[model samples]
Target: MGRLTGRQKLGWAVIAVLVFVYALFPVLSIFMTSLKSTSDIRSGTFLPPKVSWENYQQILTAEGGARDLFLPALRNSIGISLIATAIAVVLATLAAYGIARLDFRGKKLILTTALGVSIFPVISIVTPLFNLWRNIGLYDTWPGLIIPYLSLTLPISIWTLAAFFRQIPWELEQAAQVDGATPWQAFRKAIVPLAAPGVFTTALIAFFIAWNDFVYGISLTSTSAARPVPAALAFFTGASYFELPVGAISAASIIVTIPVVVLVVLFQRQIVSGLTQGAVKG
Candidate 1:
């Protein structure tokens, strides 16, 4: 079509504005709420009445005692997410490459089973997982949380990486192998490097999943010391009375969200490009 008429352009602009506002409303509301006083938060205003830094201050100071307060929980969350992502990236890349490149009997069945397990709801197995952990004395432990986290991160990471691996030309690996590299070396040298963008995207996705998980931490942790920041933040208030500063909660929320945000922000281009690389071609 030729240049849109003024009215048509105006309508399009209004639609774009509407969509943007719709998408940003929750985030904008959360930021605004995070600044509210406890009273105001309970008062349930979408916007804060007065901006006070107290909530943030309390969480940072660990007013109750600094054992596993906001910062430590933040550290724990980071550690868990990063560690899980690291484990996932390594395992998934190898698994994905193997499945995508190698031919074997029931290979389709194996990949399908892996994908099927990933599709199942986490809640279904949580109870048995909890019981198993409890019996083995693994509950409320870091590994207790990490194992379930693998169930969440690994499958999708493997699937996405597998798709990426399928896109790589087989000739590249063959060329490396012909140059005296073993299959593993061929993969390490020729395959992995070129797949860096997709790998980063996979890791970023896994990191966010592990980082954002509340279910795993909530079920596994009974004490603040063992809980991740998100779960620890929950115990800040009580049914009898809201005990802590809302600013602390606000600050905690911000603290918990920041690292994941930064990780995604840094790898945003890679994630986008990798996901979109073959979209048009496909």
Candidate 2:
């Protein structure tokens, strides 16, 4: 490609700045809101009159505020999201390997079913799942949320990993086996390293899905026993029935958002490479 002229470079720079602001403006707004005192939040100003950590204190340490609600919900969100991500990645890696390396009668059927399930509305099945979980004594439990989360995480994980697997040369595995490695050993030492980027990317995506789920988190759990951060946010209350906990909610949102931002910034290269390679063949 030829080098860009100065005008073209300036145009592209402007577009990049515009996109960055568009994407991060809401997050900036939330951060500003989080710094506002409860009274300042209602002052209808974009910037706080005076910065205050009261909102953060309310959720993080204050007495008779959101400390109780936020802490438990944060723990539940982390534990549940991690568990679901790990399970989905392991299952998806194995399933995608089979789909990529094997020729089976039902291969296409399995892919189609996975695709269908991923696209199916979560709301549609919540009623049935709610009743079923209640009957089976799984309601308001970790497993209750984890199983439903698999339904969300698995399909996309399979699709992404399968695409990535297809791009890896089969000869590498054969070469490993010829060196006296067992099939499992060959996969563990050789294939797993090669597929690490894709697997990591898939796990992140799956975690985000499970982490952000509100309907299932709210409808399935009656208490903090299984409620995640997203659903628990809804239960935040103000000092009085007539007031709102807007600042506290914003502070909580900023806290939850920090981990996601850190992950993306840390693994951006891997995420980009994995996605690009996965898309190359499919």
Candidate 3:
């Protein structure tokens, strides 16, 4: 290997430092701010005199059942994310299987139409969906939010899974069929396990999409009983219009963020592969 000049090493180090700061700054800032009291938050220093756990306590046990909504929101977020992701995975895998394996009329057109739906603006269709939900008395409920979330999750799932399926060795499926396994059994016993990485990748994408959505959650769930964390977190504001407690808000944000971070860490390799599943030719 050729030795690098000191100046070249310094240049690369500087670039690495910049990238690290860009990624870590906001996260560090959120955590640091979460530790400060309201007064120190207003003072706005990069560092604080002390760290506190009171904010976490408040969020966990805030106003009787009202403030405790954070727990429910967290639960709802998990529940909703899991249900939506499972449904999306099943539907997307089946659809991808057909597109990747079967011969059908207008296959190109159907695939194009499926991909096209992902491009439509959510805002344009949200109002119509809200009205429809209201008429059917589904508004202000978890289903209202879940159904709309599918609109975002399903298309992306299909696209990614379809790409992944294209990368699979078709000989595996053929050999399983030759061994007398039915199509469904082959899919269940072989394809699904082999596709775990891609499925998890798709599920994470869907989960985060639903977890982080604010517009539909706010629009569809009118009360705290149904509002997810994103909507419920808005209440940490003061009477004079300024936010009530930055620390409490940060604590809440930390609580909400940890699960996604954990999932990502656990599935980091899968995500990396799934993201690049279609870039190579078969």
- Number of the top lDDT candidate: 2
Q: Kindly list the per-residue Cα lDDT of model 3 for residues 204-235, writing each as its tens digit.
A: 99889888988787777877656788877876
Model 3 clashing-pair count = 0
Global lDDT of each candidate: 0.78, 0.95, 0.81
In terms of TM-score, the best-performing candidate is 2
Clashing residue pairs, candidate 3?
none
Please, what are the lDDT tens digits per residue for candidate 2 over residues 1-282?
A: 999999999999999999999999999999999999988988899999999999999998897658888999999999999999999999999999999999999999999999999999999999999999999999999999999999999999999999999999999999999999999999999999999999999999999999889989999998988899999899999999998999999999999999999999999999999999999973
Q: Rank the candidates by lDDT, best first.
A: 2, 3, 1
lDDT of 1 at 154: 92
Residue 107's lDDT within candidate 2 is 98
lDDT (tens digit, per residue) of candidate 1 on 102-192: 8989888877887898888887888898889999988887788887899889998888888888888999999998889998899888988
- By lDDT, is 1 or 3 better? 3
Per-candidate TM-scores read 0.87, 0.97, 0.90
Given candidate 3, what's the lDDT at residue 151? Answer: 82
